[model samples]
Target: MSKCIQGLSLGVLCLVLVSTISGALSHEGSVALSHEGVGRKQNVTYDGRSLIIDGRRELFFSGSIHYPRSTPDMWPDLIAKAKEGGINVISTYVFWNAHEPVEGKFNFKGRYNLVKFIKLIQKQGLYVILRIGPFIEAEWNHGGFPYWLREKPGIIFRTDNQPFKYYMKRYAKMIVNMMNKNELFAPQGGPIILTQIENEYNNVQQVFKERGADYVQWAGNMALKLNTGVPWIMCKQKDAPGAVINTCNGRNCGDTFTGPNSPNKPSLWTENWTAQYRVLGDPPSQRPAEDLAFAVARWFSKHGTLVNYYMYHGGTNFGRTTSSFVTTRYYDEAPLDEYGLVREPKWGHLRDLHRALKLSRKALLWGTHSNYSLGHQLEARVYQNSEKNVCSAFLANNNTREAATIYFQNVPYYLPPRSISILPDCKTVVFNTKKVNAQHNARTFHHVKDFSKGMRWKMFKDSIPNTEDTPVQNSLLLEHYNATKDTTDFLWYTTNIDVGSNDLPLLNSIKPILQVASWGHAVHGFVNDLYVGSSHGDHVQSPFSLNKPITLKPGKNKISLLSMTTGFPNSGGYMEHKIAGVSKVLIQGLMTGTQDLINNIWGHQVGLLGEKLEVYNPRSSKKVKWVDAKGHDHEPLIWYKQ
Candidate 1:
């Protein structure tokens, strides 16, 4: 029998179910987490069912918390809050670009100190998952690979090429040696229970044909050679070789993803995307707390053993680390916001889910799993543990629009539409995915005292290139990347087109259509100091195009086309070949004929004058005038900083 203790709005309620099962847990549904500190070795293994930690079959609730995403000062609060939120495993990607921005040069200081980050998690008694992807495409720039790597001679990324393999081996070995010296592996009792290599490479391997399969095998072998003494995983890699476990990554991996490829490996969901990352100019996304809980329950119901939320904290994308069109704020509607603040309901609801799952972990890990159809669109997934004389069960309702009532173990239980109820003892209805008992908290932002009294700001205008300055002249407009070398986002292509008084209509037309094609992501056109037009496109989408009718004087007319980039793509087929700047220029819609301007004598400028003058640095020694910018045009081509 069930009793309703309190009622809430919107059909929410609190329940207490009377227990009748004689078989209960040994410790009465309490979780004991005791792994912490360093200098202790552990024997970690896995089976088709779950991970065996020190000979004990275990299930984990994991979350991703990128260390470089935030500073060291914020690590404590973020990690402590995560521990308090019931996350036992803290996963992170060791960004290669952040560690080794240049070839043969390395850095591991401040936020990039991976050792310090792992130690902090150990201090909190949580396990760590080191995803040393070298090519992590978590909306990270260049997919976390160093820009210098792209310049290597005859090197193909993520393939079986010798140049690529040599460098990959060196980097991977360096990381392994570092971890080994520090004794960070679980066998060394340092909280790092598992490590991953070569992220999501399987997504693009099919294009490589047989070479792709060979590369996969080689990568797996190389990673396994490191001997981290813990199981290695490859997310989204279906053809993962040997003992390396292939995991799943997606929004909902329960119904869509099958079990792991190998029967001896347990089902692992490495990246359960809480919500999609926000793109620039797009509104924030929200994944309903109820739906997230339902997905979690569904995964566990389908015999999933270890689950990791892609981003539990989803911190801010500091500096220029964001990839492509993604925003600097990568909060992604996670349980923890960009500033490490706890999001209501998501944080609390997931915490409750973790606790309830831990309660039944013993049964789920060790007991035999089976499914039975209870009724229409309803099923019961039961875990029977005859060894301990205790069992657990999940009552799931697959119906989308209606609640379900099903009889299980001679008891009639109510399941809400598309939800699951957990019975830790097969009798007591302990928790339900649809029932959120935690306090629904709402927060308010309040400004501090003396908000804007002493605020002083200076701005600088990024001026266009004048005719007096000698630009880098080239017979052919250089490719954007080769010209700028990734130093700046702006590239200017300036040219002077002569129009005679007695010329044809195509050359002297008053309002001719000046067209430019494929300028990376965005472009701005100017004809003789007047802004003609601008155009933009997503970098991953089609090439950009700018077509504007221009009023050119019947003489030497200066045309300046400024090309802009969002950020380099971190993931895609042949992303290295992506380029910016206009390849073809044309002036059409004339009575005579069209005029092609590709062969014109073009002058190129890598960046803006504001960039050259160091205007962003307030204390620079250069004597540059600062404009208040209070009444100036606030459109593009202006630099503002505080």
Candidate 2:
């Protein structure tokens, strides 16, 4: 061959080579293979009888771990830990706001390198379950939807509304197209066998009413049209419509609660809330490790072929992403803490439990389950294969603080309080939730430096203080706008008011309320330079409310309300249009029955001057003076004593 032809042919051959390896199936089966690069989609089939991986029967175990929750440097270690815990697949939701913070712009570098993440999983000999929720409600801010979508006029989320559908389809296509280029689907020989759409829609189904169901069906249709050759799933969606497999998402998911409308589909647990979330002002909510093991063993004994722990490792919320409804600290008490440290007994105990479950893979993946009551909240379930050659058992005590010993086939098995024991061999008890055999490693947290002794401080005039002449948007009535990919929790509202001594007492009489309907990541109020109040709402779905009646005296009073958001609302009905800035503020009894300030021309600013200067960490600022503020945005903003 000529040198030119040889080079051209060589280039084509290299392209083909990458495509072939990138899209290789796990098992030899009928799943079609795509000649695209890794991350492409291929048709996949699950015939109720078997997963039919590449046309062959296979058993799979998966776990959930969000990428952004942990640093990219920690991915390999986390994945290794998961594999050690008997996981054959890694699952994650592609956070929308994290990827496309601004409209039409995309950032997949560094920690957001999703393609790299998937490739890393494949390297670890595991499959991937990509949940492209564009609308993931992972207790995250705004449920993972982009803030920019809210900017669109008349846009309703998770509905049959045209605007929502258009945006949803657009995002879906973007993902599919990106993956297609890489051939990430099973047919393409990549590890991705399953993909999901619209996370836990069923959790909020009642809120959608008729429009919700229609929206779900529409989402399903759009997913199918993508034809990625993988089984599409809808987690916690009861009304998922035809061909859309509805999967369970919770601490315990069993086959007993199969969807009435989709009986033909297989039962899968997409999220197993292994450990609960802990918040400040509340007692820790740690499930005894034994209970988690028991739950898994129960699922296996009850013919559950697939069970995914909601958070195999709940990593840190980090940066400004720490969401809260009230002023409470949230700790998941998971296998891993925010700092990437192992969560002692919980982690080790569950690791052992995974081993016990894996030992009974044969009986679990293909067996008939039968349950029998052993009395006293004690229950026994047996899984026997078609040939009766494989047998596994589970003994559970449902009581929160009781132990039970049950006889199975004349054999006695001891189960601890609120625990379950798994016997893969039907002879030896391997895993139990309540009984802990692992070492407990305690955690300690200390402030970097104690401010009790006090430190030197300085004060400077805030360039962007609540002042007159600031620009404000005029809205006669309440209006909510989307983030439009602007991820900052900050929105500025400035308005001038003429007040006097008589007006002040009148305002105090009627309770001059700062009724801001702000769906902020957090909210702060300022009357001129004096700080009013600040509040951080619930992390999952928190909005600020400055309901305190402020005493505003006479002479030009400048009211500045700052609404800060961690990220944009990503899920829920019309969440895209949820009000983020100061929605309503009333200075009642100013003079008449109600002198509502809703009609005042309000100046709007997107973010803080410090943020604009990229001054996230004050320690690194040599030129800037740091001062300890008595209270954050306190009324008559007090400077901390130097």
Candidate 3:
């Protein structure tokens, strides 16, 4: 009862658990192997049971490594590390926004070079799973859709709408053609064995309502037409069409998930999340290495043939590519850290589990399965090759608090609470999820510099234009993206307000305040070029108001507002419609409607004037020279350069 309640329902969990045990032990299959040489045409197919590579059943271990996440120089080392970690396949999402930031224009060089990354994987004797999601939501900008797509009139994205489908088809075809021309498809004897059409669309498909199904079907059909000669998969899309295979994407998926559509399709876990992506102001999320290893072992025990870690090496986000509110460090606490360092115990422990799984491959892939209830929350699952009397087994203890002992096949074995022990012969334990054999290494930070010697520094002030000098727009406010095209993080909103004697008397009486309402990641206010106050919004889309006191100048007074963005919203419904910058401004306590600056002709500047002068560029020919400085330490509004 306790086991059943802990699993939320004993019958369902037991039924699935029993089925997994039976599937692993009962395999009435043995297929002849076909050989192939390097650079030779190979075949990859899957029956309802398992993946057949060159006419023989095979198991695959894959890991995700986004090319754009890491520099080009890091690719070879990263791939090599993955290979050494017992990974036989490398998966990557071809980022649409990174490759084509502008419509009708594409870039495939440097870090965005998909071909180069694939080739490197192939050189390491690994297969590839190409996820070409024009709508990939890997916490990417605009969900990997180019921002220019928002400019298209009446263009509803990720749907069956004519405009969206047309553009989606064009881009998909472009990628397919490029790969085909380079002979990079599996049918062309390349490393790519599988291609993913769409990402986890089912999660947000409800927003599209009736069009969701149509869009999914369309995406599947489009991928099939590409003729890649490899299977197409749709992760997290349960109602996926017949042509595409739907796979699971989270941890412990093997415990509850089976192939969608048909049992004939092999069970595949596309993304076994090792750790979670970090957001700003949130603690780093981590998964125990022991738990991760247990998940993998249980997956294989349930007859899962292919399992891919979402991130085997979660690299750095670098630059402004991170999603809004996400921290600059893209560390997902994967097997490898952001700097390519192996995450101890997790890396070594998983390596050992992989080795143990390989030892039982023959029995697992071709034997008969049986499961027995050892009672006391302990279970024994066995896989036996009747002809050769060869057997493998998994003994599990599900109780959360107390460990249990079980006698399987008349052999007494101690089982740790909430753990699994693997026995290749069904009688001796070779590996146990609870017993860790890897070394643990703690990280420490060392101080590399002394600040006791007060160092010399130089300062430069940003040369910003006043309302009289900058270009003025008739509109009172404008969206930051539309005005700046995301070329810079800063947007200047400057306007002049006249303070007559009548307004001065009111301003002096109530201590008049300048009020501004805006949508932003952050905003700064200036009155007569004097810094007043600043405000910030949440990581997601949010509206904030700023209020600052101002001194009346009697005649004309200038107000400058600086609106800045951390990054744009990368996911959500109608995110393209989100706006930034000051929407309205007013001086309260100044005699009502007379002080409204809503319709004023505001001066607009895309970035600081110092940016134009190349003051930040160390190698610029027009770069400003630093001079010996004194006094003015810790002064605000001063820009320091090395």
Candidate 4:
């Protein structure tokens, strides 16, 4: 056999070998991989015009639907919806934080069951794109790295630093090993075909510095070294090394970027954003179905082959896992809301457009192309093979709201505002974003009542006394605690010291200056049961000053702080040592000039009474005047009932 054939045959052999090994290796039952090496061995051909999948050059449609975004119960329906919308693949990011909440602990029993999720996709007869971004920054908290990582010492993230590489390699191995053991690769007849490493690194490429290049190289090498026998992709990574294929992302990419290396590598759009995420104070933003369809048309007419909708079904950000906490994680302007209801117009309009675009599959998937810019933001393109068997055409207007007419090779075409025109036969305009031909359907679900609707409430003072037991002799005597196996956001540090009559004046009038250190993303303070205030951190560091006046009742007073985290520090630079709690809580109102109380004998507490009660769930709800259900819109102690 020739070397090429031998290599190809070995590839095939490795596929079966891996699958067989996986089947035997699985602690559970055997896992399946889809047609992994078949496309390669079949001599898949492609140009600027078409993608030949399984020996046939054809147009392919894909959509993004991360399994972690929704529950397994919702998977079948979401996949069915995508297929109904004319999608061929299910793209997702394997959230590392969700999978590994603690350092060595992994829980894939429920929603974190990536294996089951992939198997479910395969059962639906759909392809899969597994984006294993140990560093996925999908508007996720701490960019999806667990807060436990932030507890580590001197561990800078996404760099060539020894600590980071150590953890990154360990995590990558855990995931790859799981997938391989289950034969989740294509060689194992599983649905996954494409795999991604990291996410949008190019968007933050400047942050990596010179080490960025080396870090990219290290990531690619580590990922490829797994020998998954499938291609690895990096989005927005224009300078990706030879081993990793760099792909595109954005509202429009086919016209703006080209393949970094071999044309054999197909054009893949990783994130075709359907709508923008919601921001505070901004009205809910949405993309009209027509504009979205027009963008797809432009890509198809330009000989683009693979297009994945950034999110065919936008799922909810359940729990604190949603992006906004201090900012606003309640972003639900997706094609589908957090409740799984499809957004109007954009959903139906895009559905019909997907069907129409599919009709041009042959012309789009096969023919080579030529482009003609008709000027004035209007462009034209023609695609066909020399055999004269297949042809397609595209017309588009870049203007946001102006309509135009342009003659392309003697054929008059009408371009709508910010729209694209697709012609499967180079004659008829079959799909236009400006036009809608599908029925718009709206879905809404009844809200479930509180889980703690009828529970009782009881408050007991914690036995630990106060922070005065140990008076600091100097400013440098403050202490820090590391939360190890104890992963809750709460940490308690209490000490006590006496203040004589002279010292009483300094502390009483001294504003009771207390400085605290904690890794909690959110911290609440209390002095003798009086609510001091609450301070929240951004993506990093829980640094703030409690300028509120604190009084000492003659002898001793209890000072408590409750720190909470939406999710632990999962990944970053020196993330392990990322100080989250009150790094420095100063009583600055009492002191001025150089004598500020940035440091003091601090009594720190990690969590709140509400958290210990698990107040978020109704099953833990109790009846207390200050804590019981009032109405939904009340403040402070307000609770809601069924």
Total clashing pairs for each candidate: 0, 59, 7, 51
Over 126-218, each residue of candidate 1 has an lDDT whose tens digit, in order, gives 888899876789998778877777678888888878888898889988998899898899898788888898998878898778888999999
lDDT of each: 0.80, 0.65, 0.76, 0.61
TM-score of each: 0.91, 0.80, 0.89, 0.78
Candidate 3 per-residue lDDT, tens place, 292-330, comes to 888888888887888999789878776667777777667
Model 1 worst lDDT run, 10 consecutive residues: 4-13
**Top-TM-score candidate index:** 1
Q: List residue ranges in candidate 4 displaced over 4 A.
A: 1-52, 147-154, 255-259, 278-283, 323-331, 409-411, 441-465, 468-486, 489-522, 535-546, 549-555, 567-578, 588-598, 609-642
Model 4's lDDT to the true fold? 0.61
Taking the tens digit of each residue's C-alpha lDDT, what string does model 2 give over 30-122? 112222433443345775543556444555567788887777999998887777666777899887777787779998987788888887887
Name the lDDT of candidate 1.
Answer: 0.80
Better of 1 and 3 by lDDT: 1
Error of 4 at 1 (Å): 47
lDDT of 4 at 343: 67
Candidate 4 has its poorest 10 consecutive residues by lDDT at: 12-21
User: Tens digit of lDDT per residue, candidate 4, span 65-143?
Assistant: 7776788899888777776666777888888777787777888877778888887777776777788888887766567
Clashes of 4: 51
Compared with the true structure, model 2 gives a TM-score of: 0.80
RMSD of 4: 11.2
